[model samples]
Target chain A: MYLKVELNWNVVIPAENLDIKGLMLQKAILVRLLDDFAAKKATKDLGYLVAVTTLNKIGEGKVREHSGDVLFPVSFTCLSFKVFRGEVIEGVVHKILKHGVFMRCGPIENLYLSNQKMSDYQYQFADNPCFLSLKTGSRIEKDVTVRCIVIGVKYMEAQKEFQAVVGLEGDYLGPI
Target chain B: MQNKSGHFDAILLCFRCRHFYNLTRVFFLACDAVPFVLSLCLRKIYSRLRARLKLSFNMSAAGEEEENAADLKIGDEFLKAKCLMNCEVSVILEHKYEQLQQMSEDPMNQVSQVFEKSLQYVKRFSRYKNPDAVRQVRELLSSYQLAEFELCVLGNLCPETVEEAIAMVPSIKSRGRVHDDEAIEKLLNDMSLIKKFE
Candidate 1:
């Protein structure tokens, strides 16, 4: 199971007494997080945690100097078996491409349903003349079941690439 | 007796001439006094009118000053609130990033595309990192005419690795537990901290 966390940026120092150089150093920490965590291999323990950071307010330009360090808190959440493959997930049909259907499961997130993965009934129904004539915005009112499989994961160091595989199968194989 | 009648008529005329002249002089003096008295009254009225005009002018000037003071006060209060909010957001982002950095084994190589895109926020914070950096970012943000300071911070906070950036964003822990809007709003609000980057 993955833990879910919510995060945002908060300035530890007041805007009237902020140090610009200090803020830069502090921001560097965020850069490190961007590089280290978001792109890494998914571990069983890590599950599927989503981290988020927000920026709320800023002081005026005239007095921003002498203001303390500007802080940013990146919040995150962990989705256990719910969002993983094989979990019964519900989503809206966002788009239909020549290859497959795309479902928007959550904000800023999307999933792809390849044509090959569609069940025979879905394939046949979609292939029908009436279905083929449907437009892009047409709502799909069908449930799909599929196992989550680690199709491909990539890690880049400088200009190098590394790959990792996670197998998602079993009851995690349906579309809602 | 015939000579006495002529002398008596001459004597009567001579005795009244001087007295009549004195009476005429008194009459002219009274006419002159009337005009002098009217002039004095007019002077007093003019002075009072002039004083009233001066008072009104002074009052208007004072009113303008009071309005200016009120406006300045409002602006100051608003800026203060804004500064506090920005500070909070920056702190939160820093804390979350630190936690993720510690947890990850290979902090450098992770390159999630989504995370990579999000790390652009680091640049936003870069504006507040230093005086010089803040100045530079302020100019940039101003040129773009952006209202939110957080956007500027995000512009400066680009991460070196994409995966690390992705890790910074909180993942969905469970279905129905987190609302995407709430998360995004929080992120946006936190990013506003860039307003204090100066």
Candidate 2:
């Protein structure tokens, strides 16, 4: 589910938090830098940051002489999407495999719907495998929009994000 | 549009039994929460019930073991997409949009020039870019007690026929129709999927 989460972050600015052309630190530039740092960042608890929706609080800046960079403490409200177990998401079929298709579900790119999850669907190989259902003779192909429910989630340590295994075995969650 | 092997129906049947599976899960969670409250025998019974339910589900999965295994089972945070078309005019070089336009020419886009545009822009929902359609469908289906993925299905597929629609969607009692025909029809029309249905 998508949610608004308040996150605390430490952002760094090169060249003493101010451009050499400008005399001193600026709030607008700082906020802009902070937004760039925060957007699309994966936090420990809060899924992925979509965008900086609001800037509620800011902290004093500390400058380092050796690095000539300034570090600032900031707290902001950002839009985040956290895919939970049993959560539903919409996406398009990106890659067609021998077994199933991989849906590029927003930040969760590998949300998979295996052929096993497809009931009564048969896989045919004629240079390409199509998920064919004898009941409807329908073939779920690549780029088809599908509704899917997240059945299982396993956090990938390499990327430090959760990978969700989505199932199409539910109501109103098939090809749209 | 094809019903070659009743695969869709099999999936629907599995969905129909989802509530039973959920109930079993709840029972298991309850046992775990209050281990002292529930006896060892009851826990064993709960596990047995869950196992039985899973077995029943396996049969419904179209006899495809690998498909079920993958379904029963993405670390890219950033997307590197160059918008070939800006807000203004776009130039399609490696273009392939005729097939999508053939599906449905959505009224939401530039109606006059929709045929010339990319399907990506015409689609309301996307996992990478837009969440507007997904959010709207979620809000619409919130009243119905459906699984999270079900909303995705409804928004994505937007099935036309009653037979196809009913498989993904739960029963609607307040539609005042005998068999949810009108509701499903209205939903597809409302979602601007008349071309797809036709």
Top candidate, metric TM-score: 2
For all predictions, the C-alpha RMSD in Å is 26.7, 25.1
lDDT of each: 0.37, 0.54
Query: Which run of 10 residues does model 2 chain B get worst, by summed lDDT?
Result: B81-90
lDDT of 1 by residue, A1-176 (tens): 11223323232434544346867644554454444454442333223223444333333323234544444444433221112222222344445565555544322234565555543313324542111213232223333222223233233345332222222222222332
| Candidate closest to the true structure, highest lDDT | 2
Give candidate 1 misplaced runs (Cα > 4 Å). A6-88, A119-176, B1-198
Tens-digit lDDT track for model 2 on A55-164? 66668878888997877777876544556554445667777887888886555667788888887677777766567779867677777777776677666656756577
Encode model 1's per-residue lDDT on B166-189: one tens digit a residue: 222212212343435444444434
Task: Output the TM-score of candidate 1.
Answer: 0.23
DockQ of 2: 0.05
Candidates' chain B TM-scores in the order shown: 0.28, 0.27
